[model samples]
Target: MKPLQTWVPVPENSDFTIYNLPFGIFSVAGDAPRAGIAIGDQIIDLAVLADAGLIAPEKDYFTQPTLNRFIGLGKKVTNEVRLQVQRLLIDEDSELKKNPRFLVPQSEATMHLPIKIGDYTDFYSSLEHATNVGKMFRDPENALLPNWKHIPVGYHGRASSVVVSGTPIHRPKGQVMPKGAASPVFKPTGRLDFELEMAFVVGRNSDLGESVPVSRAEEYIFGMVLFNDWSARDIQKWEYVPLGPFLGKSFASSMSPWIVTMEALEPFRVKGPDQDPEVLPYLRTEGPKNYDIDLSVGIRPQNGEEEVLCRSNFKYMYWNMAQQLAHHTINGCNICVGDVMASGTISGKDETSYGSMLELSWGGQKTIDLKNGATRTFIEDNDTITMRGSAKKGDVSIGFGEVSGKILPAK
Candidate 1:
């Protein structure tokens, strides 16, 4: 496909374009969270368009809060609306394009939580990341724990605490067991970190006892976004002896403002990781349909210094999105629209490609030298972290903008 021309005046240097019609929730001032689409530097209000009879849902879906109503319509309408919006915004013959009143400047728009997530599940799907993390705690003989390669390892995450991009995350207070301590003590997290990952938003619900196959998994996916699952290493190390992470992970998770539709990313799908042993029947797919997207993380200190930490790729993941989704509903689990599932800590084989601060610092042994001469092993209070992703195919690039969060001191 050739490059698309848009009247929105986005320069060649710009990442946001008509090709990437990302969706989100935003209100003018004090209204409830409603669906909106990003175009150029403006947000096209979906609620307004729906009210005008421009886009109406077949189901009584528009009544719900967030984008779940429209999202429950599934990929059929999602693609339809995306196509309609693209035609209206880019095609000169479109009625909405000719009308200047329909456009809203992005600077004035107040972005909010795009969807009301019912549940959050994060998976350790990246092969290199898992190996790196395992290498830190485990000795040379037992790097990867058994059962890791057999199934996609995951844990239920706190949904209520997940925040929109730019939200402030206060450092969490939890019990930590120091060396030679029989009991744990309560204190704020000292070794805070950011997990660089990508997550997908569920578009359709699967009824209990009904499983979604890998073949039809894409229909249930609405879009992709950046996800930062904050971690407190000290708390996790002490508490996660037998059970998985609890308070250290539940404190906060940050996601991007705009969600890039899967349709927009269709052209960029590459071959996914090859499974050594045969996967389960439900998790098996015909071919690799994963995208070779470039991912990078940046950190900014409270003192006003910024440094690029790591550069990795989504292709490093051992499991694909389809497999993850298929496995999620395999056991009669109900999955609702707008439920978020993240691919945990995407890292590459090289040292420079570490995704989380824990991996970058090598379990707090070495110092991560910054450009400004400052070094860090874990996140400091007031530090801002951003994760971004993009897939470039010659001239055109598919972007999932970025997700960012600022760490604040505990109350």
Candidate 2:
């Protein structure tokens, strides 16, 4: 679809165009979470449209802290709502074109979490990230573990601790093993780090005894968001000997406030990395299932400026979204609306494509030179890690604004 000619200053082009009806909750006058759709530079308040009887049925699901209630209404209802809102916002034939007073300028509204997360699971599905990380601690033959290729590897994460973007993350305190030590020492995390990931929000619930097939997996996913699963590497290495990450990962996670629906991203969708040994039957997919979103990580020291640290793409993932969601329900585990399934650190072949400091510096054995004669291996206490994403075609760029957090001293 060609771009529409709207008076809102979306430039001659913008990502939040008429075609993209991304959803979010906002408050214009100190109200609770009310549905809104991004159109150019304006926000179409869904709750108000519903109340005015301008939009149909899903109106009752508005005015909540999260989008779970609205999302629970099913994808059929979701598609209809999205299409109707799209027409109302862009089509001149609709009543929205006649009444512009009810429209809230995007600049004045506040964005909240689009969904209420009940469960979160982070998956290790990046091939290069796995290879690079493995090469650091083991021989090339031993890089990928025996079970790495066969299944989707993941760990349950702390959900309550997840925060929206713009939050300040305190340096977490944990046990770190000092050099040549038979025992470990406890202290504030010294090696804070960032992971560039893409997270999907669950749209519907599935029963405990039923598995969501790969074919119908997209139906369960409402949308995608750029996610930063903050980490404390020093603490993680010491504590993850037996079980997986706890304090090292539980401290903080940041996500972009806007939930870009699957429909909007469909144009950029493509096939994922090929599975060599062939995925397990439960993890099989029959179509092109990944989106071509260019993602990156940028770091700015407290005293210094911003430098694009790494660049990568979501298409580098070895396991696609469908495979991840399918494997998640293999045990007949029930998944509810608002549950988050995240793609782990996305990295590519080049040094600039490395997603984490562990990969960039090869486990702190080398130093990364900065623009102003500074260098770093892991994040400093006051350093800020910002992650940005976009999918550009020709002159227009479909963007995921950014997810950023400053590292504060441990509390």
By TM-score, how accurate is candidate 1? 0.95
Which digits, one per residue and each the tens of the lDDT, describe model 1 over residues 1-22? 6767777766564557777888
Kindly provide the TM-score of model 2 when superposed on the true structure, using C-alpha atoms: 0.95
**Per-candidate TM-score against the hidden true structure:** 0.95, 0.95
Q: Cα-based RMSD of the predictions, in order?
A: 1.9, 1.8
The lDDT, on a scale of 0 to 1, for candidate 2 is 0.85
Model 2 residue 138 lDDT score: 73
Residues 147-200, candidate 2: write the lDDT tens digits: 899998999999988888878999999899987999999998777789999999
